[model samples]
Target: MAEFKIVLSDRETGRSYKIDATGPAAGALIGRRIGEEIEGGVLGFAGYRIRITGASDRTGIPARRDLPGPARRRLLLSRGVGFHPVREGERRRKSVRGNEISADIVQVNAVVTQRGSKPLDEYFNRPEAAAE
Candidate 1:
């Protein structure tokens, strides 16, 4: 039973969540393409879904190049890419081991695609939920 640290970030909000997951389910997340959706319950939440956007190893180097500018900046900044913080909450800080995570630790970047009864509806009045 190995535990892997995962960081899930909300695209709309600049907030990131650190979830510690174990077992084969967490392992399956590796290599999944961006835009793929996963159950949020796996990260200990319900009524929510996560869409994978990017991932990185212990060193904080991105696994993909298509990440949005803000997302990339957040990841790098969390890994201490810039000057040291002068105060608390200066930059986005990850709760997981800072740059020293195990090789199996995959920091995942994701956005909440669904919450409660509402799926993220980009199209106004389309009501795509009925098709699901």
Candidate 2:
């Protein structure tokens, strides 16, 4: 089984979490969107949901091709010329040893959208019930 390290950050709270995934589904998260939701079983639980915010390879290169112009420029400048310049909406691909390597260690940045085996509504029977 191929293992992957997923680093998720809450966009609102700025809190981050590290999760380890081992399976084929984990590998399928490579090119997902920022707000896309994934099953928590990929992390461990069965009923939970994880929302992806950002993703990158192990080396820190982002998997998404929609970075802003300034951010893209900054990344390119920092990584030097070895990395090919990519336009907006264009993914970077490289060939090595007769194989195409896009990303080896995919670092998935996400947020826990849901948790536990029960529905979120079950936790709160009424609006007043959440006040306590």
Q: Which residue pairs does candidate 1 place in steric collision? A: none
Predicted candidate 2 versus true structure: per-residue lDDT over 12-125, tens digit per residue:
445565667666666666444556687866655578787865555455555443442212223323232225555654544432110111235456667777766653333335
Candidate 2 regions with alpha-carbon error over 4 angstroms: 9-15, 28-31, 65-102, 117-132
Minimal lDDT window, size 10, model 1 = 93-102
What is the per-residue lDDT of model 1 for residues 21-129, given as tens digits with 9 covering 90 to 100? 6776566564455567888666655678888765566665554434332232334342243335777766653322222223344566677887745433321234553
Mark the 10 consecutive residues where model 2 has the least summed lDDT.
94-103
Candidate of highest lDDT: 1
lDDT of 2: 0.51
Candidate closest to the true structure, highest TM-score: 1
What are the clash counts of all predictions, listed in order?
Answer: 0, 0
Q: What is the TM-score of each candidate against the true structure?
A: 0.49, 0.47
Candidate 2 residue-wise lDDT at 125? 55
The 0-to-1 C-alpha lDDT of every candidate, in the order given, reads 0.54, 0.51
